[model samples]
Target: MRSLLVAVCLVLALHCGEAAVSCNTVAEDLYPCVSYVAQGGYVPATCCTGIRALNTQAQTAVDRQSVCRCIKSAIGGLSLTPNNINNALSLPAKCGVNLPYRISPSTNCDSIN
Candidate 1:
């Protein structure tokens, strides 16, 4: 019984690990862009790198939605103005990432796919 319980636990853990893109990962990937987004100037190469990386990482519909939600949530937590938000949204295109949807707190993650 103990062995069975251990197996179940392991399986559950593995399943949870594969659930979706983590918010922490999302935050880390976008960290370099915060300065560029908040302020105005030439966008950093590192920022573009992070944006491209995130675009590559979020492949599936579920993964995209997960990333979308994470981005939206993070945006809410920040004190960016409309110009800042515009900068953030424009980062993807500037970085050569063709995001399917806009990155705004108001975006509906459910319709990402």
Candidate 2:
């Protein structure tokens, strides 16, 4: 009984951890792209790396929606210009992620899935 309980707890913990996506993690991964996206400059290597990581990490529909929400919130908090928004929207294609939904302030995250 004790071993069964321990095994169940371990499985639950792992499942919960895998299902969680933190906003801070998304922000940190996307931070490197700010300058390039906001200034219309070349996409940096670090930004590509972060984009790929995010693409890989957000495999599920739920994860993708979470990422969209986090990105939308982050962009809202920033003072990015129109050019910046355009560049940022283009990052997924630039990085070859082929995201299903567009990344914009008005993107309905509920429709991402």
Candidate 3:
């Protein structure tokens, strides 16, 4: 569906060199959170699962920076409100995933590593 398209686009768009994790994988993992991030409803178990999976995969500094860039790109593509942006930023915490850097478009992905 839409997620698949997003994944494909992300894979083609992200040119952050090679990493264990792909942008397509990143999009897939975070796709489930879109609803909760946009609408601010009950957090879905599937979303949290994806969040945890992403956290586990992004172990190295390079991987983490790639993930951060992917997230920022994804968020930039979305027409989210300020509240929705807040939700997206807080999503990892809600899902029990403590990311080293904040997931905002303003985040400096290059500085992560």
List per-prediction Cα lDDT, in the order shown: 0.71, 0.69, 0.77
Model 1 clashing residue pairs (backbone)? none
Tell how far residue 24 is off in model 2, in angstroms.
1.2
Candidate 1 per-residue lDDT over residues 9-97, each given as its tens digit: 34323332232666666666777776777676888898788778878888898888877877776666555679978987888888888
TM match of model 3 to true structure: 0.82
Instruction: Output the better candidate (1/3) by lDDT.
Output: 3
- lDDT per residue for candidate 3 within 37-92, as digits (tens), equals 76787889988998899889988999988888777776766556788788888888
The clash numbers for all candidates, in the given order, read 0, 0, 0
Q: In model 1, where do residues sit more than 4 Å from their true spots?
A: 1-18
Give model 2's TM-score versus the native structure. 0.77
Among these predictions, the greatest TM-score belongs to: 3
Per residue, candidate 2 scores C-alpha lDDT tens digits across 57-106 of 88888888887777776565555568867998999888877876777787
> Which candidate comes out best when scored by lDDT?
3
Cα-based TM-score, every candidate: 0.78, 0.77, 0.82
